[model samples]
Target: MDLIGHVRCFVAVAEERHFGRAAARLGMAQPPLSQRMQRLERELGVRLFDRSSRQVTITRSGALLLEEARALLDRSEEFLACATRIKDGQSGLLRAALPSGLARETVAAILADLHQHHPSVELELEELSTTDQLARLASHDLEVGLIHHPCDVAGLELGPVLRCELGVLLPRASLLAARDEVPLASLTGLGLVLFPRADAPAVYDDLLTTCARNGYTPDSLRHGQGDSFVHGLILSVNAVAFSPPDRGTAAGSPSSEVVWRPLAGAPLAWRYSVAWPHGRKDTAIHAFADAVPRALWNTAAVSTDPPPRPLHLRPASEYWL
Candidate 1:
């Protein structure tokens, strides 16, 4: 019934103490403003003002309700402002996921950046594998995710892709560790410690194919995502794992127990990007996607300069050779 509008008119008239001045302040004609005041008084069954030929005087009821009416208008404005912020994605819950195996620092940076840009968006962040993230995205359980490449992206939209070049992680005592850059073929006899195939089967397969093509084929392949677990495998099982250069520095190996060396020619790299359900992206999703590259670059030294290349699978018939 435009109850708020009536209250606004009443307050203006009470404050101005004249219908013509109140109408001027409200940017409305005096007649309509008078009618609004009349309607409000009729609805409330109370005289809001005493009109005289020279002036208008606010009644006791009108004086008492003036303060309350002002407060109500203020509250209404605040409510609408809050709604606008939510619609703009500046306030609300944003559900997102990241793959496991990222360094803690990298994760922290991502959270910090998002908070800096959108302090009111409560980030419900989770650590999930690419496969699991895709599942959640499809079900509407997740709004955005930082996912590894080469998986199914049939119904998803992707952000800018970054590639982090991989280097060999081996025991310090290994002969290959002494070289500034280790050739992939130099580690022919060592077992490979890799993330579980179930986590990202396509990437896993692509990595193996690249290794084979580069003249290195691990004698055995073992799966582990955790740094400690991969390190343990490297020491106990005579294996090597590939990781970004920053992982070695972050790990801070003592007494030179383990070392990371760049792979000759930088033949292997892990590609990553932010993903969201197709046609479902919003301001929050874009904000999160923008934050990802900055955090990865700051904490993990991931390269965002390279042009994105889609993951191409080798022919199954030729992959085995």
Candidate 2:
């Protein structure tokens, strides 16, 4: 047996204090493990395990060897992980774009997970609107997109669709802010702040359609881009805006200026998906996609067959707005 394998067997037996348990842990038979340990002790010219009818105990030399073996195993694991990260085509950069107004913890959590799994992967993140993300993805300029659902771009597959319900972000002074839940119709007379209809049609259309379906429509929606900007309008003005639910607005200890209230009557839910272009089959893209947790998402994939003919797709011109 190699030195590492011998050391592994010794460490497992020492820790388990039973040859049977150590063999089970190692997925080996008892006889081979016992033989391996004996060989290791003979090679070292010192006894490691003191065995009797009832029990097995580590000797003085075994205790000290245990510490060194564990350290060596840990270093070996790190070395193997380093090789895996940089060996395959995974050792490159992944350029990603994310839309604003996502749940506060979304980006940080994803980045943290990616770092842990693939330390060699370098990430470049951009805060582009869903529209821009679609455009860049089509041209192969961007590798991954954390975007809103209902993305209509061709040649890209959507996946791990996450459900994010919406809440009303209202100023503290508004009458509706005092209620635990705000009725959909309560927003009828209030000013509404929205992303430009073109930027995120899925979100914009869904917001308007849900409101209209429930017998209430905003008289006029002032177009704005960016979650922070829309939120600013809500905070400083007597306006209502769509916000992701449960992010310190609706719960106890509401913010000083803005309060979150769930939209009652019609279910207000939005979806998010991690998008990547099809047929590219890039390792880094798949790695990033795999790193995202599946707990909160329902994945969907479009076909890999290329579109038949050349067709014009929408350019992300509104990205600057």
Query: What lDDT tens digits, residue by residue, belong to model 1 across residues 207-275?
Result: 888888898888888888888888888999999999988788744366657889899999998889999
Model 1 lDDT, residue 182, Cα: 92
At residue 57, give the lDDT of candidate 1.
99
lDDT of 2 by residue, 144-190 (tens): 88776555756777555655667777877778878988888777767
The 10-residue segment of model 2 with minimum total lDDT is 301-310
TM-score of each: 0.85, 0.61
What ranges in model 1 sit over 4 Å off?
Answer: 20-47, 52-55, 250-252, 279-281, 305-308, 311-321
Residue 312, model 1: lDDT of 45
lDDT of 2 at 125: 82
lDDT of 2 at 220: 59
